[model samples]
Target: MKITREVVQGLYKQTGTARVDTDVAASFQVGDTIQARNINPTGHTRLPRYIRGKKGSIATDNGVFKFADSLAHGAGTQPQHLYSVRFTAQEIWGGEAPAQDSLYIDLWDDYLEPA
Candidate 1:
């Protein structure tokens, strides 16, 4: 895979470590478990508008934790953590979503709220 400089920088921001490389790749499949927490105290991003306040089970693990680069405000990073948390659609979206519909998102350890 073609690694980029931004990806390398992203790892440093989340982990605060510079030992990582851009070529190091990691990914997750379905049915994997993970954790998602709220790091944003004042502002907001695209981390699921509803899941900001509640903690749910990992419905599907997708890929590695690509932390955002400090320069990019933690927007990108390399694949380090191998797991994704999945929350039930009903748990996050409420009764509006179908019973079978669940929300699966790939979040880094910093985003988890601690089960």
Candidate 2:
């Protein structure tokens, strides 16, 4: 996905106008199911290399989705979108993760929960 100048410009405006704070965390709760797409279904993605083939429930309820940034996609674009998903570390990485810890990745609408 490529982020157009218009989208970047809008982000700039939002940041400049204080509509959105840079310190904000898109995922702030549990059970928040989000929609995401495999950045590189063939290769690797920052979406936690562990969460490639497994599935989990939304443990948080974060607010509106936002961009995941193409920095992980190897495009370095600012493709912005809406995403709200929360998964257990075990769900993504399996038994190797701590039982008390989980990973909440802000994804795009393209990645999602069970319908």
Candidate 3:
């Protein structure tokens, strides 16, 4: 089925009625170095395994959405900021990977901290 903005908004409106601290986005900007939090491996998570504890720079703001950590298990959709973070291949793989290669990942506000 084709999804529309109204459908997305309706979903959020129904599932994300709970409010959350969204001001965290104001602390980040493009090029800001951020470290992905090494959260305990448990339950469903959107944060990739390879990117845990890795440092990256904010590439873009992907706007606020329902926090996956909470939404995965019937918890209310606590809205939070999402951003595109760029990580060097060397940081993710190793020095032998490629000096100029990088990977971008979309991450939630709770999963990142100032590096």
Candidate 4:
């Protein structure tokens, strides 16, 4: 992939989604239950430590996008679906936490799996 003048110009000229489109299959979907993968990478990542190993449900499919963790390390885009996941306060903070509350965060597919 060359970064020629036309490539830069074409990207800036886009009118629709700025998200990268790829054929990668969605690992989860809206309403699908998932658990954040427990990981502690020594490299750049957006996955928060608090969310790791916690259970949640997919609230929205935000579509495919480049993996920032990989990008930061000079790895390929590794495009995959990103989603808005909803976690109950109880689920995340345990039974002592308020049951009426919830926390929503966007996460990439690589950070989650079926719960």
Best-matching candidate per lDDT: 4
Put down candidate 2 lDDT per residue, 1-115, tens digits, no spaces. 6899988888766453212233444332344344343444545344655554445555544443333434455764333333345567776667988988866554543454342
Model 3's TM-score against the true structure: 0.76
Candidate 1 residue spans exceeding 4 A from truth: 1-35, 41-46, 59-64, 69-71, 74-82
Estimate the overall C-alpha local distance difference test score of candidate 1: 0.54
Q: Please identify which of the two predictions, 3 or 4, would achieve the higher lDDT against the true structure.
A: 4
Instruction: Write the number of the candidate with greater lDDT, choosing between 1 and 4.
Output: 4
Give the Cα error of residue 73 in candidate 2, in Å: 10
Q: What does the lDDT come to for candidate 4? A: 0.92
Candidate numbers, best lDDT first, in rank order:
4, 3, 1, 2
Top candidate on TM-score is 4
* Sequence-dependent TM-score of model 4: 0.81
Off by over 4 Å in 3: 1-25
lDDT of 1 by residue, 52-79 (tens): 6666655444444455433245544534
- With a 3 Å backbone cut-off (N, CA, C), the pairs that clash in candidate 4 are none
What TM-scores do the predictions have? Answer: 0.49, 0.41, 0.76, 0.81
Error of 4 at 72 (Å): 0.9
Q: How many backbone clashes does candidate 3 have?
A: 0
